[model samples]
Target: MKPTGNTILVTGGTSGIGRALAEAFHARGNQVIVAGRRQALLDELAAQRPGLVGWPLDLDDPASLRRLADAVRERFPALNVLVASAGISRPEDMAGDCWDGFDAEAIVTTNVLGVLRATAAFLPMLKRRPHATIMATSSSLAFVPRADFPAYCASKAFLHSWLQSLRHQLRKVPVEVLELAPPYVRTELTGRGQAGDPRAMPLDAHVAEVMALLGRQDHPRGEVLVERDHARRWAERAGRYDATFVAMNPD
Candidate 1:
């Protein structure tokens, strides 16, 4: 995507990387729309940034997504960039007797199916634009797995593969499909504790790097990866998959 002058919509644009990106893009002169579940947060965000829009969205609900699509088409017909930044992360222990499929189901619903559904909803408008971009957030764990977070890792892995096909199919449509594989960042994605974790990359630092990467058009083959994401993202190709997996899932 260009550095500016593009209308953009970011799902999960309430907190963490999503909000940061929305703000960054807004500062760049993009017509920015921020969609999320919390009305209060949306209102607050819009107030903070003059032209930034805040729309309500619940990715797990089909009807809500349909409403978002209709609104985007009506309000921002020229919108050419979509960032599927909405996702949930949870740790599930399969060995537990009380473990049911609920967490896994929820994770899949929000992280995997959510992006697919959103793409379907907005692709028509995107296709109309001469050039469009669909950027979805995957994870460094997508290339490997954390045994404790099986479902979460699997969901991201699915996106890593699915986005490849999407990129190929959208080639004729002239839409660029970008995948964001981020390493552990100081975000409340997992829990509030994560926000203060020194081991995790600082949220602002991560977003700055990503914005810079995009500004420089440094993404190779449409994968927006920062330096820290390299080891996990290429472990398999580097013949370190087993070692990485073991390290990430220590006994």
Candidate 2:
């Protein structure tokens, strides 16, 4: 789908990749709506971008998602694109006795369930447009598991699978499904340690690659591996990806 002149809503637009995408879309002259749970952040984004709309949405809550759908229909009925960029990452030590605690649950609820909620809520609106598209953010970890961040990886893997299936199912519809699989990048979601890590791509560089990828008519079957990186390529090396992961994390 063409990037410009479309009305788009990006969930988790308060920070990280979501915010960067919102800014990019706004700059391209699209009607961009930034949705997130934080009202203050939404206000800040609106203050910065004149035509941008900021909507407070909590994807974790189904009722809230439903309400958001109604709001979008009433306020921005021409909405034709959704960027499921809202997500969370946590080091899930499943070996620990407290695996059932809040952190693990929060990760699942926000990363996995939240995507599902947003998709279902806005699907009807997307259907209204003749050339709509849904972009789901997967990750390099979706292909290669980081043992320590198992929960986050699993959620992304599930989304990747779901997007693949959704793409097949929507073949007859105007709505297009695209999966964006990013490698580690310099962003707040990666934690401060990842900020200084040489392996992480600069935030601007990562988003620029993604923007170029999205501009193309070709939608990658399962993933769009942004720019070449050893770690990212190794993540998809079939059954052998594990050995590469171990080598990188060797103690």
Candidate 3:
């Protein structure tokens, strides 16, 4: 990724890390299109940042994703970057007697299926470009699972494996597959006040570090694990997987 001069499309651009990344890229002189389910939020983001384009998209809907791909191909043929950042996280209590409140299906549908569908839709277009990048937002929990958000962590784990394979298959091509494993960041994904938690990293700082990593030309790898996440990012390799898992999900 050349940092600038590429047309980029970022899903989940309405809020959180996605929005921050879109804005950062836009600031660097790249033409950015922010796509999300909520038209109002997209419009607000567009309003707040002039020249930032907004496109309505529903990652859960296959038709919507296909339409988005077609629209992108027609509107921005030069688009060389696809950031599949849209995701959902929900707390699940397995101890509960009732299964009605569990959100495993929804989490898998959005986080896993959504990324697969979106990538499939845009892959052809991406392949046509001289050079392209496909980036997905995984989580550090993929390496070290969190008890509260079981499905979310599992979905990201799936991404870790899938993206690794995708990178291998596309190694001979011009496409670059990148997985961004973020630590617990202050974001509204889990509800109100989560973004302000002192324990969670600030959104801007996370984005800055991520941007810096992406800006590197010599950094050639599948995963982008930041400094804060380095501990868990290599927990298994560092011979501390069991300890970290127990610590992260204490009874």
Candidate 4:
């Protein structure tokens, strides 16, 4: 996927990695439309960045996603990049109270179902571009599940599977599906208290690497894992990787 000279739509652009990516592309001379659930945040983004467009969006609802699609088609028909980055993450334990179960549902609905809905809505418009790119934000947990956030990990794993299937299906089309699995990042999603965790990577640091990866002509699909240790562990020994994850978090 080319870095600049393309119209892009980044979901969840209000904050976190999504915001960083939107700013990165905008700095590189790309027309960026930042979409999220909060109008106030959108307004703030628009106010802060000249030529940056912001649209209020709710990813969980298909109707809202379709409406956003229609708006995009009408306004920016040449949009070539669709970044499905808007999602929520929460620790969920099935054995806990009702809130825990609710947390699982909310995470799955937003992370998995939201991506599916948004992709279906904008797919037709994306095909019109020469080299369209569909980028979804997965997680390192997708490869190795984290016991604390069971649903979050599973949802990201589902995204990895879904994007792989979508990439195959779009082989004949102009669109290219890319799954970006980030390691723990210092974002609001991780909570303020967890930001300083040694395992967590800085958001700006990760975004820089992502920008470099996306600039390449031959961007790899399926799962693009970040953070050296995770990549190395997964690459060197598949059996060991599985064993480590299972051992660390026994069911």
Runs with alpha carbons beyond 4 Å of true place in candidate 4:
97-100, 229-236, 246-251
Q: Which has the higher lDDT value, candidate number 2 or candidate number 3?
A: 3
Per residue, candidate 4 scores C-alpha lDDT tens digits across 196-227 of 76667888898888887677643444455555
lDDT of 1 by residue, 211-251 (tens): 99999999998899999999988898999999988888899
Candidate 3, superposed: residue stretches over 4 Å from native: 218-220
Candidate 1 vs. true structure, TM-score: 0.98
Worst 10 residues of 4 by lDDT: 227-236
How many steric overlaps does candidate 2 have?
Answer: 0
| Cα deviation of 234, candidate 2, in Å | 6.3
lDDT of each: 0.92, 0.84, 0.90, 0.83
Estimate TM-scores for all models: 0.98, 0.92, 0.97, 0.91
Best by TM-score: 1
CA lDDT, candidate 2, residue 60: 73
Candidate with the greatest lDDT versus the true structure:
1
Q: For candidate 2, lDDT tens digit of each residue in 76-129?
A: 999999999999998866677878657767888998888888888888789879
TM-score for predicted model 4 compared with the true structure: 0.91
Worst 10-residue lDDT window for candidate 1 reads 122-131
